[model samples]
Target: MSPIELNKRQDTILQIVKENGPITGEQIAERLNLTRATLRPDLAILTMAGFLDARPRVGYFYSGKKTMTTASESMMNLKVGDFQSLPVVVAENMTVYDAIVQLFLEDVGTLFVVDEKSHLQGVLSRKDLLRTSIGTQELTKIPVHIIMSRMPNIVYCKKSDSLIGAAKKLIDRQVDSLPVVNETENGLEIVGRLTKTSVTKAFISLAETHDL
Candidate 1:
């Protein structure tokens, strides 16, 4: 399961409650310099999501429950394969110049490389190609496999992996994309691609599902 994500204001309210427990609604509002009417929605949401509790004649206190229904809850439950797009790939033996052309023609920042048997071999990014094409370097002579990130060094995802896990990996590794692959006895077989666009699409779909 993924963490229950909160908006900026919600986070602030949570911090305030943690630091000053049993805080009254009016006091909480004063700390944030917001009117009680404006902060009501957040308070109600926090209470409903089990993040806060209210007592008669008292104030609001932290519930100590971590789970909540977030705007991205639908997205977090989705599988990586559900949002993966058709992968763009090039032969490992393809020239760097040709790889550049494909990268542009396909309008993608990264490309997966494959062996003659169509097994996953490596990954090539725009930066990788650009780095090799600089100065007097001969891009036409250099094979993609020479500069591509080889297997075992590549970060990938399985179809069954959760979407939130994928997002975390993307942020943690600082990579633009991840290959959706299948593990075979021989090696991983690239099936699809998961990029920032994929995550955006998932979010849009989730929002639509909620009629929001």
Candidate 2:
């Protein structure tokens, strides 16, 4: 027969065991306001599923092997809204030279381009500025809109997307940053950004959780 899946209560029991492991069944029942008679079935099933181990006198302990996959699953389910970084925006009319200064000052690889109305126009990366500065010093006179990437072709994401989805865009496109946008009455508004660094920080957090 196939193994039984853990129900919500069982999941909780497993968590309690992990946190307060080597704890007795009586203590687990007391913490949840449940009687040993009522909690025995769940405790038995978790132990049977290899999620918990019970000693003759030492109560319950968590099996250390299974939490790796659980932590990975939790990382994949994280939403973009909570992790996005503040946008570094420049007006479309700004000069490329000025935009270059802002780019360096902000120390970001990509900058979000916006019109006076605060609507997204395009994106600018260090490459864009470097290409503009190669032979032409007219960067001071040229408007950013002249060299900036335009919209519709921009690969972007909404605030509600998963971090894994945003990570894919960064990887597949070989780009360093993506503008997090939201559709509005006039046009798409730049809300936040997802960067390669953001993904790194997330991975670090997952690693820390796994170590715990």
Candidate 3:
């Protein structure tokens, strides 16, 4: 998604193509005093970078695309549903002690609290459990709902939401993850989870896919 910096020969090739458009690779090589075989790699790079368009018989022409697709553009196109992980959920009535155990068992930083219908109720984070554990009250006696971040305060994203938007929510809300939810007549239904790790993996995938 980053800009492709052209080398000296590449820059000259681009300029040549721009001035004398629809030029064949052999012709361009002749002007540069180089063999077509020598320029093959550069032509491939330019075409793949969106700087040039190739045709069957017409040959290569300037595409007018100054650079590869911008990072912001690519990120905005990444949907949360594509990279979201399975939701780790717990009942709101579950004891904090059990929640902590579940957290460890699942190896997740956050848990979604739901009701009998599996509708979202609140969110329990490791920090919340840790803070409560240090208190005098027994962890077994306290329900997760007592400390979980309640709805209307919980920041979440839809499956169709952009990964970049979800990432921004994570940063602005200062949370490690966001619930990927679906809207129903009752309430929000947890479909998945978008975490910082998910975003990182998505970025890595994008880079590798684009050969950036």
> How high is each candidate's TM-score?
0.64, 0.67, 0.67
Local distance difference test, each candidate: 0.80, 0.78, 0.84
With candidate 3 superimposed using the best TM-score fit, by how many Å does residue 190's alpha carbon deviate from the native?
0.5
Looking at model 3, report the run of 10 residues with the lowest lDDT sum.
203-212
lDDT of 1 by residue, 1-212 (tens): 23455667877998899889899989999999997756765675566456788786788888886656655554555677667777999998899999999999999989999998888899998788888888437888888998999867788998789877998888887888899999999888999888888888666545443342
For model 3, how does the per-residue alpha-carbon lDDT over 1-212 read when each residue is reduced to its tens digit? 24456667888999999999999999999999997856754675566557888898999999998656554565666677767888999998899999999999999999999999999999998889999999847999988998999978999999888788999999999999999999899999999988999888776655543552
lDDT of 2 by residue, 1-212 (tens): 22334556776887898999999999999999997756754564455345677798988998863533354465666666656778899998899999999999998889999988898998998898899999597989998888887866588888789888999999898788899999888998999988988788767554543342
What is the Cα-based TM-score of model 2? 0.67
Candidate 1 whole-model C-alpha lDDT, 0 to 1 = 0.80
Better of 1 and 3 by lDDT: 3
The order by descending lDDT is 3, 1, 2
Q: Which is better, 1 or 2, measured by lDDT?
A: 1
